[model samples]
Target: MYALNDIVEMKKQHPCGANEWKIIRMGADIKIECQNCGHVVMLSRREFEKKMKKVLKKADSDK
Candidate 1:
């Protein structure tokens, strides 16, 4: 499962041509920032799940 600070690959690429996003916030809505352009987007959990391809990097839990 994806968590805060995790890098995830979306099913589609952002306008900046970045396919990777960093999870910033989570709850009923999930917030993601584009790695290339620093663009932030908020999506519903359901929508996020549908659009997310996979978790590229899991967040370090040992912090």
Candidate 2:
């Protein structure tokens, strides 16, 4: 399962030209940050699950 502070890859690239995102928060809703332009966005867990391609990095123990 994905957790906060995890780096994930999406199927499509963002407008800023990055496909990498960092999970900043989790729960009923999820927050993700773009690695390229420092953009932040919120999405539902189900929506995130549908678009998530893979987990590139796992969260740290303290994150």
- Per-model tally of clashing residue pairs: 0, 0
List runs of model 2 lying over 4 Å from the truth. Answer: 61-63
lDDT of 2: 0.91
What lDDT does candidate 2 reach at residue 44?
94
Position 9, candidate 1: lDDT:
99
| TM-score (C-alpha) between model 1 and the true structure | 0.93
How well is each residue in 1-63 modelled by candidate 1, as lDDT tens digits? 988999999999998888999999999999999999999999999999999999998889536
The lDDT of each candidate is 0.94, 0.91
lDDT tens string, model 2, 1-63?
Answer: 788898999888899999999999899999999999999989999999999999998877545
Lowest summed lDDT over 10 consecutive residues: which window, candidate 1?
54-63
